[model samples]
Target: MPTPIIIDCDPGHDDAIAILLALAHPGELDIRGITTVGGNQILDKITDNALKILSFVNADIPVAKGAAAPLLGKLVTGEEAHGESGMDGPALPASKFKPVEQGAVEFMLEIIRASEEKITLVPTAPLTNIALLITAYPEVKERIEKISLMGGGLAYGNVTRTAEFNIYVDPEAARIVFESGIPIVMSGLDVTDKAAIFEEEIQELKTRGPVSVMVGELLDFYSIYGKKMGFVGNALHDPCAIAWLLHPELFESEHLYVTVETEGKLTRGMTVADRRKKPDQPANTEVLLGVDREAFIKLLFDSLERLDRQLGSPAGES
Candidate 1:
């Protein structure tokens, strides 16, 4: 049987691809629901982007609006990167799908409690919703299989000198989740920065299908910053979480004692990974340090090919 999972996202350019990648592997992942939080954009924008993207792909997954702000601070979005629309490049149809009436926490509680199996959470956004879930309903902690999240890093940071964007957006919430005792798989910048999908790949991807074209266009806009930084390609950051869930063998990881720095003067939102010679605390996060970039990209391409098969020909292929 496929493993049950929930995707909590912010619809960053990479977040949309992550959802498509997960959707393609219906046999491996029984996606129970998707919850949207404020990160790449505001809750309203990201949530609508989620609905529109799923509608484009004809997926039936339930979506719920999540935290509009962090647990303790004002919301800050990655709008400078993702643009005003959040998903700027894709000219998607207006969403025919409406999110479930309940908020994200309640929707998550309902899905988790009703699932016969423990649900793994794929959080490609800030930790706000997850923290609220566990804090409000402590009993649900035992029902979670694990949290496979795209944030933090052992030695790299995207948003601050020592902080990654997702965790940096909501350090208080991240702190709560990191300390919650649930097993975690951290697909942080250490691996994700290496998970770049380059120029030629994006160009070729556009010809594959409707989904591929959408993804390719999103990547086109997304690659500007990476290219400016002189990276070989754009980092497909959020997709690393789903990739880890599907193909753990493609990545090398270290079991480290990790904590979120909520109150550091210069390192707030930094994930303090204890890589000491002999640490007292037990390992809390499976910190992804390296990845087989070739195999990981192949996995993404193959998944998109599978999705292409499910739909009709791409536009202009008639």
Candidate 2:
């Protein structure tokens, strides 16, 4: 049976690809809906981007807008990285998909309650919507299979020396989710940094086919922000979570007690995994620190190819 999942995201370029992967690999996962939150951009833009991406792939999934800001701090968006539109690089057509009337949290509760199996929460953005849903419906806690999130870093950080953008955007929300006692699979910077996209790969994608053309276009738009940030290539951050789900063997992780810092002058949102030499705290999460980059990228490209075909276009190298 395919694992049922709800992707709570902010539709960063990588987030767009992650959704495509989930929808494409029908045998691996069953997507319930997409919940948009404030992070890579403001709530409205991210939600709009999510709907747009689904439409691009001809997916008919429902969308729900999440919190406009974090639970305890002012909302901060990465306009510099994702642009004013959140998914600024591609010149996408107007989205045909529309958001449902209920808010993200409400939609989440209803989906989990109705699903026959425990739903997995894949959050590739700030934890605002996931935290809110968990808090609002404590009864759903035990029903969640696990949470797979993209944030944090065991050694270094992208947003701060010790934090990732998603967590930094909403530290309080992250704290709430981490301490919720649910099972967690954290694919932080430690793993995603390895999932880089080289120029040749993007070019190959462009020539491989039209799906490749779309991917190439997407990456072209995605790479601009990365170059400005002093990165040689763009990392497909969001897809790491989906890739981890598809091929857990490609990644190595440690079971540890993880906590998110909600308050600190320089450490808010930092995922403080107890990597200590000696500690009494029980392990709560499987924090991934390494990944097989070659395998993951292959999985990603293959899945994207599947989606292109399902969306009524030919995809190469499948």
RMSD (Å) per prediction = 1.5, 1.8
What overall lDDT goes with each candidate model?
0.92, 0.85
Model 2's number of clashes is: 0
Measured by TM-score, the strongest candidate is 1
Q: Across residues 246-300, which tens digit of lDDT does each residue of candidate 2 receive?
A: 8899999899888988778788778888866555577888998888778887887
For model 2, what is the alpha-carbon lDDT of residue 53?
86
Could you tell me the lDDT of residue 93 within candidate 1? Answer: 94
- The positional error of residue 201 in candidate 1, measured at the CA in angstroms, is 0.6
lDDT of 1 by residue, 4-100 (tens): 9999999989999999999999999999999999999999999999999899889989999999999987998998889998889878899999999
Worst 10 residues of 2 by lDDT: 309-318
